[model samples]
Target: MDAWEPRPVPSVTPETEPFWSAAADGRLLVRECPDCGLVYHYPSALCPDCFADAEWREASGAGTVYSFAVQRHLGYWPEDDLPVVFAYVELKEGPRMVTNVVGCRPEDVEVGIPVEARFVPTDEGGIGVPVFVPTEP
Candidate 1:
């Protein structure tokens, strides 16, 4: 298998700082609205549904693959990392997030497969980024 290329470091803004901080400690977080009980990713100060204040909550880190695509070519990425599996994982807490599915061959990933979150730290002591891997059977 080809080794993955280095991931781009994500920019941490005030809205997403907490989420990244939790990830660095090997934890996943989601924003939930107390009023309507709506859970969401991509940290925000208010809920998308009712515009209520959203609070940060730890996620289960367990999810299922909702959808995916295999990238065979990209001008910037090296050939060794050509076949990266990008997926949307539906979390147990009820929101889907876009992330990479790693730790296995790209061809092996499929919809509905069970997966769990893992954190990969970025270069220069940047925050950890969440990725998924197939759960052990």
Candidate 2:
């Protein structure tokens, strides 16, 4: 999707309502478990652990690239398309989130490469999507 274009976010069930609402404000929100201080994505209303209700809050979005790979051949991603930098960012607070690495060329990504959140406005139907771009050098 074009960074400048807003498209509808295809899914928004009752459970995920709060997440979309926060994203609309240009905030990157994550679920935090009060019981264990755990944070995660794929928004959930309840903490999987301790059955504690989840709290919605802003995320620092600062993290490091845990691991990645260069796709030698893939039709889904165009030949000239930006390289996909999939990462599992381990938050300083305790949650590790799965997300794509953007803003930098794929070759620049490496294990432990530091990154911070830069939210992009996106629409997945009616739900707002908070896509991340790497912090500028």
Task: Quote the positional error of residue 69 for candidate 1 in Å.
Answer: 0.2
Worst 10 residues of 2 by lDDT: 1-10
Cα shift from native, residue 32, model 2 (Å): 1.9
lDDT of 1 by residue, 28-83 (tens): 99999999999999898999999999999999999999999999887765666668
TM-scores, all models, native as reference: 0.91, 0.74
Candidate 2 at 127: error in angstroms?
3.6
Q: Model 1 — TM-score against the truth?
A: 0.91
Number of clashes recorded per candidate: 0, 8
Please estimate how well model 2 matches the true structure, expressed as its whole-model Cα lDDT.
0.65
